[model samples]
Target: MKIGRIETFYVPPRWLFVRVESDDGAVGWGEASLEGHAEAVDGAFEALRDRFIGHDPRRIEDIWQVSYRGGFYRGGPVLMSALAGLEQSLWDLKGKVVGLPAWEMLGGRVRDKIRAYAWIGGDRPSEIADAAKVRRDQGFSAVKMNATAELDWIGTPRLFDEVVKRVEAAQATGMDVGLDFHGRVHRPMAKQLAKVLEPLGLLFIEEPLLSENPDGLRQIAELTSTPIALGERLFSRWDFKPFFEMGAVDIIQPDLSHAGGILECRKIAAMAETYDIAVAPHCPLGPLALASCLQLAACTPNVAIQEMSLGIHYNVGHDLLEFCSDQQVLTPEDGYLRIPQGPGLGITIDEDAVREAHKERHRWRNPVWRHSDGSFAEW
Candidate 1:
């Protein structure tokens, strides 16, 4: 079926939703939430709408190739994210048309259920024990939290101790804890923090140093045993090539929504498989993004765990599953999210609610942080 109409909705609390309809009236939904930059992604879609309208919806790979190579300037957060959302919509529509789940179409189910983790301790990250307990009671076996707040390029030893204590508090609940440095820690401290947290037995240390610092990451990798998990920032498989080649990462967290869509991520996971690296997709957006992750986790063998934004800090007024017709479809059970067995992405969207929420339109932006000396610090 040819694509007839495509639409994007900038929902509250920072999310970008995509809807695509075939000429015959079949519809599909996908999320391209770029967190702080929804508007840019929405604008990037203008080019995609022009390119893909009246094109065949079932030609997923062909459409992706044209979208990527057709545009001389390609492969970044904005354009890739815009393409990612539209690509996911095409897959969903194809899966529905074929009367099979996306995973089934990819290959077949490799696992019935995939493990999931919840976010706690917000951006600054404190009072983690209570937060961990709450997640444990909610049937989560693991939880992740930011390692620290804004920090100077070089901080005192006490700052390291504070981060350790926060992680220890979360671990006290007998739950697996993954510490996300969130690129807030620079190379000087990133190496030190990884060394210090090496003894914690963490599930993983996410973005310890940012993906942009490959040399720093390799040095940090040499110093610590903790699985260096990054790649949320790397938008394409080409972007992830160096880290894998350097043997610097143990677990790669490719965001399905940002690192191209389902098929592209599957290909990335395949490349990571040769290095024996694990896949724990970085999804902290909405139900559709998480659902797309589940579809990948279902067929890919290396996927270690999935991140859900169910109660994440950034989702101020709107939590995950807010726009889903059946929230339970994407809901985690006993710490593991079951692969969706339904057609397409499996979860049904509440288009009416999405359209209604778009009316107010969120202008959510990430808070800019400054060091004690007033210099810019990563947030």
Candidate 2:
């Protein structure tokens, strides 16, 4: 069927959803939320619609190639994220027409359920022990928290004692803790923090330094045994190749929405598998984004754990399940989400809720943080 129309919705708490329709009345949905840059990603769709309106919706790979190669300047967050949503919706539409789930078409099921981890402490972590206890009571065995609020270039060793104490408190609740540096730490402090936190037995340390600093990452990886998890920012397999080649990263956390969609990440995961690196798709958006992540986890063997945004700080008025019609598809049971078996992405959206929410279109932006001296800091 020919692609008849493409529609987009700006849902609350910062999410962008795409709906694709075929000439003969087939429909599919996907998320292209780039968090703070939703407008840029939405603007990207103008070019996509101009290129692929009358094209065959079933030829997903062909569409993807044309979308990428046809555009001379491509492969940034905005372009790739827009293509990711379109590609995901094409797969969803094809799967629905054929009466099969996205995973079955990819390969087959590798596991019945994939373990899920949720966010506990807020950006500037506090009361982590109690937060960990709450997550434990909710049946989550693991939780991720920010390592520090906003760090300067170089801090004293005493700056890390509180960080260590927070992790220890979380661990005391019988939970695995993943400390997220959030790319806020500079290389100097990242090295020191990695060294100090190595003894805590953390599940992983995310973005020890931003992926842009590969040399710094390699240095930090050599200094500590803690797994260096990154790639929430890197948008393509080409972007992730250097880390794999350098043996700098132990775990790759590609966000399905950000890193070119489901199939691209599957390829990236396969590349990581050759390096013996684990996969943990980064997903902190809404339901559609989480469903896309689940589809990837269902077929990919290297995926270690899934990062979900159930009660994350971003979802202020709207939570994960608020717009989801079939909540079971995205809900965690005992810290793991079952592989969705229904057609396409396997989760249904509440169209009414989405349409209503779109009317109010949230202009969500991440907070900008500055150090005590008025210099810019990564937030």
Candidate 3:
């Protein structure tokens, strides 16, 4: 029952998977993929291993507390992500030991399935109409796409017509569209963009302005009735509290792997529930991360929709199900992902495939974009 070893595998398409083993032969898996910074997150595990080795694996919360508070310097992407992976593995271990799914341990499920969404257009979106149709054919009722690419600080209103056109094209396919400004829009543009896109009845506008500018976000929220979804960058409940308090956001999209793991996100969801906000986790990573998100969705009532990485543009050579043994557990049906009934995170990892893929670990980095004037733009 004591934690024996902790190992991290850098897998394909930019993912870091952690494997935790107990002295008594229990094994648990978690993902700590921090997109472009997998190595930093992987490096963070060095301290986690030092702290958690020989400790009780079943003490999930204690491990989390120590990992976070004991570090003295905590709550950033790298440290929290590393802690998140370890925390998820501990839950996986404890769930398997008890012969119950993680959700069952987390007060059972509130829904049998959650509505799921897929990414339509690539980072620099184009031809979204066709992509939306493809997603509809794939049984997804909703799709998200970048609203614009590398926008200038203060562009003309005409720049948004194409955005409206793309959204119209997707909505033409009878699919709900969520336009992600991707924090590429500054305040001047965000207000205009949010005002213009308000008529489309979007599912949400994600990161119209980055979380750093809460005042800007609040202003955009006031400008439009569209559900302002953010928190992909905000890592914890402390980070998310102000948005809820200020009425700045309608939906919180905490990334399970980047935020603190399952329990932490569940707590965040509970916090959002008080504000009557919805939860739609941001998961553009691989299987383990998606499975971790599903676990949260299974138990939390506030979770409205789920985002999956299946066929997302970032999954270059390897897709979401590459290293998963039972893809059906994570697959979408009728535009919803069924609650995983299996113990732990509910999907089995193909360990051999993971180990094999680790040999050729990917050095994936998000594309860097520049404005027409050569100033750096958010990607």
After superposition, candidate 3 runs with Cα above 4 Å error: 122-126
lDDT by residue (tens digit), candidate 3, 211-260: 99999999989989999999999888899999999999999999999899
Cα TM-score of candidate 1:
0.97
- Candidate 2 local lDDT, 1-379, one digit each (tens): 7999999999989999999999999999999999899999999999999999999998988998899889899898999999888888888888899999999999989999999888877432358888887777766899999998756688887789888888888888788999999888999888889989989999999998988899999999999999999999999999999999999999999988888899999999999999999999999888888888889999999999998888645487678889888887887788898889989998888989999999988899988978788888787
Model 2, runs deviating above 4 Å: 122-126
Q: Which ten residues in a row have the lowest lDDT in candidate 3?
A: 121-130
lDDT tens string, model 1, 3-62? 999999988788899999999999988889898999999999999999999999999999
* Models, CA RMSD each: 1.5, 1.4, 1.4
Model 1 poorest ten-residue lDDT run: 121-130
lDDT, candidate 1, residue 95?
85
**Ranking 1 against 3 by lDDT, winner:** 3
Global local distance difference test of model 2: 0.89
